[model samples]
Structures are given as C-alpha cells and as structure tokens.
Target chain A: MIARLVGDAAGVMSGGVLIGPGDDAAVWQPPPHRAVVVTQDALVEGEDFRREWITPHQLGRRCLAVALSDLAAMGASAAWCTATLCAPAETVLDDVLALALGLREEAEATGCRLVGGDLSGIRGPLVVDVCAGGSVEPERALRRGAGRVGDVLAVTGTLGGAAAGLRALFGRRPPAAAPAQVDAWVETWRRPRARLIEGRRLAALGVRCAGDLSDGLLVDAERTAAASGCRAELRLEQVPLAPGLRTAFPDAWGELALGGGEDFELLLAAPRPLLERIALDWPPELAPITPVGVLREGSGVSLYADGAPLPLPRVLSRHFA
Target chain B: MIARLVGDAAGVMSGGVLIGPGDDAAVWQPPPHRAVVVTQDALVEGEDFRREWITPHQLGRRCLAVALSDLAAMGASAAWCTATLCAPAETVLDDVLALALGLREEAEATGCRLVGGDLSGIRGPLVVDVCAGGSVEPERALRRGAGRVGDVLAVTGTLGGAAAGLRALFGRRPPAAAPAQVDAWVETWRRPRARLIEGRRLAALGVRCAGDLSDGLLVDAERTAAASGCRAELRLEQVPLAPGLRTAFPDAWGELALGGGEDFELLLAAPRPLLERIALDWPPELAPITPVGVLREGSGVSLYADGAPLPLPRVLSRHFA
Candidate 1:
C-alpha cells in the first residue's frame, strides 16, 4: 500500500534527482559551487496537531513546510526532501494516499523533489518527520551570528495570525470575531507558508542575519540576540499584527503577536540603510517587510510600546522549556 | 535539557560540516564532482524495539548504522547525519544524553559527523528517525538495476547471526545453544555493523549491482532480481552461516539464514571473472566475501540445496504485511 501510494504520488521528477524511490537511497547531483543546508523536523499527532483540526493532505504539506522553514531561515533554495511517516495499521489507505499527494504538491510548488521516504506501522500517534536539503552560496548564506549592534530587525508578513488560529481551534472562550475573520485566522494556522522568496532576496541583497519565526517573535528574537552577542529591543507598536487580531483579542493581541508560534515568516537583521533600500526594492508579490526592532549592545530582549517601556509577557516556547 | 545534551555531545566537527548544532540548519560543503546520496530510517519504541531489549546507547548506535547501511549499499562514503528523537516528557535526560553519546561515538568511528537534530516531547512511544547524506561517484554507484544475467552473486560477512540473536531474544521455543552462544547471538543482534568498508571496496573494484541485506537474503535478492529484470539462483549450501547458528538450530538455520532481517551486510552481483578478481584484491581487514548465488535470465528467486531444488521459506517482512 505504501509503495502504491508513493508510486501514485511520484509525479514528474524535477531538480537533479538521479535516483528516486525504490532504491536503497535517493541520489541527487547538487549544483556546483554551493553548500548544502540540511535540517530535520517532526510533528507528532497530539503534540503538533489534532486530526479533527487538519486533513491528511494539509498535514502532509504542513510537515514539509515546517521543515522547509529552516532552510528558508538559512537563505537556501529548496532542492529535495525525504519524509518518514509512522501511522497505525488501522489508518485508511486513502488518507495515506492523500497525504503523499499533498507532499508531492508542496515539493513541486517549492521547487523541491520528494525523492524518497519510509513508512511503518505504529501503535500510537501518527508521526511525520521530514528532512529537507537545499543549496546556498556559502559566502552569502544567512547566519544567526551575523547581527551587529545598531542593526535593524525586520520581519516579513504579519504575525499573530497562526496563534489566533490556534486559539480559535482550542480556546475554551470562543474568540469574539466575525466568521470571515475567524476563518482567515484558521487558514493562517493550517497552511503557513515559508517565506522562501523573501529569504532568498535577503541573501541576494547581502543581508547576513535571519531566522524563521516558527517559535514566535520574542523567543526567536532572543535566540538571534544570544547567537550574535547582542540584545533585541522591540517597538511593539511597529509590529505588523494580522488583520483583525487586535479586534479579535483586545487584551491578548500583544501576547499573541509576541509569543504566538508557527508564523513561518522570516526575521532578518541588517543595517538601517540597507533595510530601507531593501524595502524600497522589495517585490510586490512577496510579503511586505516591516521594521519592528533593533539590536543593541546588551543581552536578552526588551519591549517598548509607543516609546514607553512595557513589561515582557510570559513567553511560551515550542520545544525548549 | 536537549540543548545542553546536544552541546555536550557536539564534539569537534569534521566531514565538511561548516555549521553544526544550535542553528536553523546545518551547512556542509560537499566534495566536488560527486552526487549526494540521501536516506531516512526510523526506529520506533513498540514497532522497532522495546525498552527491555536494548540499552539506550546500543539503540542510538543501531539507529545510525541502519541508515548508514543504505548509503553503503550505494557505495557512498559516510558523510554526515541528522536525527530527530521524540520521547515522552517523562523520559530521563540521562538516557537521551547517553544515546547522543553513542551516536557521536559511532559517527566518529565511521568517519562521519553528527551535524544537527531535533528533540521533541511525545505522548506515547519513543521515536528516533535518522537522515544520512553522503557523496558518491554517480558513474560508479552500486545500483540494483545494474545486475546482468550470469553475474555471480556475492555477500560480505556471514548471515543469520542477527536473526538467531533475535530468536534468542523472543522465540517461543528456545534454542538449545549454550549460555555463551546465546550471549553472542544477543550481542550480534544488539550491535549490527554496517559493511561500509566492504561496500566501498566493491565500488572501487568496479562492481555495479549491490544492496544491503537489511531484509534478509530471500527478500532482498528477490527485490534485486525484480529491479534488474533477472532471476536470482541461490546455492543454499554455499551460503556462509554465522558461527554456531546451524548447530544451535539445525532445523531452522535455513529459514533464519534466508528469511530473517536486520543483518547489515552487503550483497553484490558481478560476472564470475570480475568476482574472482575482486576477491583476489579484497582487503584482509574487511569482512570476507563469499559467492552464494548467480543471476540468470528469468524472474524471481530460486534456491537449490546440495545440487537439488529446494522450496523457498516463508519470508516475513519487517514492516509490510
């Protein structure tokens, strides 16, 4: 059944995939003069998603997107990916087929090939682990350690939508929002897109420091600061919140914007002049880039609202305690 | 705890690893003029192993070896690997650290590097998935479709040891082996080694078709035959049995040797003269190569015992039904 599903979803191979499925391993001839960037991420059924909240197709695409976000964070172009799915024997074959199809679609959309994968029967929750590899010019690749003092911190797209969506999915008190707004939030949560174009442009524009907003702004900002030996200071008022987020949760909008995870947006750091130039030349098709913070000669992260000091909210991390 | 464990296990990096842990993704510079071979394998708690059957250290090493076997089958040198471990929150941090240590040890021993990984909290069983990447000459890669009619089939190292070891661990009817022999069998099962040296030697010797004996001889041979559009004729009497295996299970040795899985040995196919030439130049330090079969113009696999046709045993797959 797994073989049939893989065959049905194989589709037309792209990139430089020389050996695809049904081999001991997939072989690919990577482009020359490029470094390979690799990352692995996994989503367990209960921990990462609820079956009722996501279809198998959405889950499949979401898994690849989550892993690809790391490559985006590194400013690497998508190349290929391999996935491992562990499901219960009782799982419907159609679900598996739909999941593989979704994966194939996402791979094709991102210019990557679903070269190979493994499937197995499990006695517990479904587990999807994806390992993505991409190529990047080594000298121009983005790094967390490249932030400098007085550098401006910018983010692509709006934040807090996915967090709002999660609340809509699991919060006991239903958000007081219009149905259309709620649906938009849910859509953001279900299918967060990796900012691939924005990431590549950053690298092309000579920006060196950036990371994905998978763990929200506050946590990721702090991480970037620590890696670069500096501090992150955010102007809360400048943060671009998702549409209707402030209206949906007047009191909690700040929390969601600062602590909500899975935004899948790129957080970049560069000199103010360079950032201004990038904004002037940014493509209209890509998400809008907004300056939200700056790096300073200190440690940790700080927040300010309308130039007034604001206390930091309790941050919830995705993995770290 | 995961961060600290990774930090402690992050030894001096090698194998073109430019960026190791504590990053969005690892960056590696691959050797020029080579193709990248990639494979992913996972070991789940209930499906692939049990807590009572193996130590954390052994499990760690075993997981990496399993993935590396795929690269070996393609005659790719070990390069680097990333792993994801999903465990319940109640899991002991010490065990996780020990497992990482074991992985690091194996990586260093095999001239590979542990570049990056993910650690997650699970609600159910432990899950460890590993993705390994290596460089191989595209023109010289060992492939399943490269076998030809009249090619002599050879395998490195002896078979059935791991199977016998598994039997000693879980068989309903215990074999009549001595305590020392049983201990050896258990050790063999617990610490299977990937035939990396033998695989590289085969590729260097211009051998074309090869695969790892991950699913025992019968199943893998059948797969090779189907891939190459030829029949695999096995001389059952010529197969090299693990020491004391036949003595321990005289009635079941054939089945175990031909049908049992998880033996990390290499199976190769080449013409008679080429096989003899490779044998003449085989390194003494590597595992011994033994001829046990031949490829013919037909389909499926056939077995002969002492010059007489023998019935194939019921092959039990590790995962597929």
Candidate 2:
C-alpha cells in the first residue's frame, strides 16, 4: 500500500537519494561536507485539529508544513520526509490516499521527497506524525540558544491569521467578521507554509538565533529568550498582524497575535545591524520580516504597547500548557 | 517536559552530531563518506500490543527495536533517532519519562543517539512513532529486488518465537504448556532485537538481497520473490521454529511459525555459494543463519514439506489484510 502510494520519490532533493522508497529503508547520499538537521512533529485529530475544519488533504499537508517548520527555523533545505499515518479501520481508503497525496504534493513543492513511512490501524483518533530532514552548512544553521542579550527580534510574514481562523471555525465571534476576511484566515490556518527560503536567507546573512512561532510569538519568543539566557521585551503595537486581522478582530487581535499559535512564522533574533542588513538584502519574493521585539538582560518575557507596560495575554495553544 | 527527558543526546553515535537536543532540530555531521539510510515505524497502544503484556519501558524499547529493524535489513548502522510520543492527558509524567528512558537506553545500546522529538496530548490511545537514520556504504546495501534466480534464501536467528509469543499472550489454548517455555516466548514477544550487527556483517561479506522478517517467513519470502520477480520455494521441514513451539502447541506450530508477524529477524536471499560462505564464516557472537528455501524463475511463493507441496497458511498479520 505504501509503495503504491509513494510510487517513485519525485526526484532527489539535493544530494541524490540512492534508494527510493521501496527497500526496508530509504538511503540518501547527502550533500558532501554538510550537516543534517532532522525534526519530528505530529497532529492528532481532536487535540491538534478537527475533521470539520480541515479536510484530510489539508491535514496531511499541515503535517509536513508543521514538521518542516522546524527545519526552516534551522535554515535547512528539506531533503526527505517520512510520515506515519494511523487511522481507525473504518476510515476510507480514498481519504487515506488523499491525505498521502497531500503530503506528497507538499514534499514535491518543498524539494523534498517522501522517502519511507508506515501505515497502521488505530482504534483511536487519527494521528499523523511527520519527520523531516534537511541539510545545512556546518555552524550556519539558526539556533534558539544563539540569541544574544542585545539582539533585536523580528518575525517573517504575519501572525494571528491562524488563531483568528480557529476562532471563526469554533464560532467564537465579535460583532461580525467580514466573510472574505474569515475565508482568508481559514485558508492561512489550513495551509501554513514553512519559511525555508527565508530561513536560508537569514542563515546566509549571518543571523544567528531563530525559532518558529508554532506556539504563538510570545510563547516562542519566551522560549527563545530562555534558551539564549536572556529576557525578551516585545512591543506588541509594532507586530505585523496578518492582513485584515486588525480590522476583523478589533478587540481580540492582541490576544490572537500574541497567544494564538500555529502561525508557522519564524521568530528571528540578531543584532540590530545584522538584522537591518538582512532586511535590506531580503528579496521581495521571500516572506517579509518586521522587527517587533528585543532580547535584554532580564529573566522573563515582558510586553509593552508603545512605551506602556501590558500584561501577557492568555495562551491559546493546546500544548499541554 | 521533553527537554527534561531528552536532557542530552547520550553520546554521538558514529561521527559526532554537531547540534544536540533543545533546538529547533538536531544537527548531525554524519560520517562524510556513507549514504544515510532512514526508516520509520510506529506502535499503537491497542493495535500493536496490549499494555498488560508489556511494561512501558519494554514498549518503548520495542518501538526502537522495530524501527531499527528496518535499518538492519538495509545493512545500515544505527546513528540518530527521533521519537514522537502522543498520550492521553491522564497519563503520568513518570511513565512517559520511563518510556523515554527505555528509548534512550536502547538507542545507547545500539550506538544511536536520541536526537529530537515532539510530545503531544492525544484524546485517545497512546501512540509512539520513531524515525531512525543510519549510515551505509554506497552500493553495499542489501536490497529486496537484488535477488536472482537460483539464489538461496536464509534467515538470521530463529523465527516463530514472536508469533508463538503472541499466541501465548492471547492465551490460545495449550495442553499443559511448560511454564518456562511460555515465559520464554512471552519474553521474546516483549523484547525482539534488531539484527544490526548481522546486517552489517552481511553487507561487509559482499552479500546482497535481504529484508527483515517482521512478518512471518512465508509472507516475507513471497514479498521478496515478488519484488525480485522470482518464485520462492520453502521447505517447511527444514524451517527453524522457536524453541519448544512444536511441543507446546503441536497443532498450531506450523501456522504460528509461518504466519506470525513481528519476529524482527532478517530474511536474506543470496546465491548458494555466498550463503554457504556466510554460514561457514558466521560468528558465534552474531545471530546464526540457516538455509531454508530457494528462488526460481517463477512467480509467488510455494511451500513444501520435505518436497511434498502444502497449502499456504492464513496470514496472521493485522495490516489491513
């Protein structure tokens, strides 16, 4: 079944894969003189998402997007991915194949191949776990702990779109959200792309510290701060909110941008000069970056609106928090 | 929680890993001259094993063994592994930590490092999926399609133990089955080892076609034959059954040995001279190999009892069959 689904890996991702999909395992002759970065992430049916909100295809694509987000944060170009999908026996074969197709399509788009995987029966919620591997030059990968005390923090693209989408899907509403805005947010939530190209740009520009905003910017910023042994001070007013977020979510925009997770955006930390240089060199094709915070010599994360202090918002991520 | 559990990737597996845990992803500088082999396997709580039959530690170890078994078949050496574990909210922290320790211990034993993973809350049964990566010499991998007509089929270690063990676990009746034998079978089911050493030996010894006997011999032999475009003929009388299997469940022994899955042994196919040479040079330290069958210019697998044709048994693997 897996072989039929995998077919042939859509060409090799960088250094050609020697064995494609069929043997007991997949073999790749990696790019010479480079380091390999690997990460894993999983999405559960009820815990991470719901069937009503996202189709099997979207969910499957989300698995690779989420997993590859880690590689993106590391400034690694994806080479291979393995996805293990466990579903109940009654699940339709077409849906399963569609999900597999979703993963395969995204992999091909990202220049990665579906190398190997296992499909099994689960008497529980549908589970899709994806492991993505990529390559980076030695010592060139971005890292959370590489953040410095005086580093300015910036983020690629925008935030709050997915959070707003979740709210719209769950019917948590205000006076009213425009139908077009709601649909856009829902699309963002359904298909979050990893910032692989932007990450490579950052690494090439010598930006050191970075992490993905899967658990919202504030939470991930705090984590990055802690890992770097520095405190984080964020200017919420400066954050680049997703398009129409401020208009559609006038009241809850702050919370959604800061606490609502799964944006798949990247949080980058570097000195002011380096960040400015990267911002200038960044092409129009890449996800744009906007400075929103700074790392400081303190212990915890602090929030501010302009010059005034503000309390941290409630975290909406369901990560055992 | 995962940070506390993973602490540090015990030690580098082969060529040292550049970046350890506690990052967006783990970075490894693999042995510069070898092709990397990767595989994934997952174990669901109820579908794969019952909690009553194995402890959390054993289950965790079982996950790695099953995953690395694929690497073993590919003649790859264990290097780095990532384990994603999803459990219900009610699960104890200690148990999860214990399971992590089991994976860590087994990885260390196999000379692999626990690089990175994700922990998530599932609303239903526990799920553990592992991705293991290893290094193999270029063009030295044992492949399923490498088999040729007149090639002899062999297996490393004994088969049927796991199948018999599964039967024992399910309490399939026996007329006064020995206590010692039952315990041994149960142990075998609980702790099946991957034949990594034997696999590397085979590759080093210039042997080619091979695959793991995760499924029973007959089914796997059929798969090998189909992949290689040849016919497999197995002599049931010359087969190796788990010790005491014939005496314990005399009536079911044939089915268990031939149809039972999860044995995690390596089923190898090579020409007669190579098999004989491998058998002669086989070390006591490695799992013993025994000749069992032969490949011919035909299709499908055929079974015989000391040259008398026999009907194929029902496949006992619960893999959507």
Q: State model 1's lDDT.
A: 0.86
Model 2 agreement with the true structure over A224-301: per-residue lDDT tens digits: 999899999999999999888887777789999998678899998999998887777679988899999999997689
DockQ of each: 0.72, 0.77
Where does candidate 1 stray beyond 4 Å? Answer: A1-3, A8-13, A171-175, A319-321, B1-3, B8-12, B171-175, B319-321
The residue-by-residue lDDT of candidate 2 on B1-321, one tens digit each, is 777777554344344678878888999887868988899999998888887988889988999999999999999999999999998989998889889989989998999888889898888889999999988997899899889999989888777888877777887646667878888888988998999999999999988899998878888999999989999999888788889888887778888888876878898889888878878868998889988899999999999997899999886783422
- What are the per-residue Cα lDDT tens digits for candidate 1 across B153-224? 888888888888777777533457887887787788788788887888899889999999888999889889
Could you tell me which 10 consecutive residues in candidate 2 chain A have the lowest summed lDDT? A7-16
Winning model by DockQ = 2
**Against the true chain A, what TM-score does chain A of candidate 1 give?**
0.96
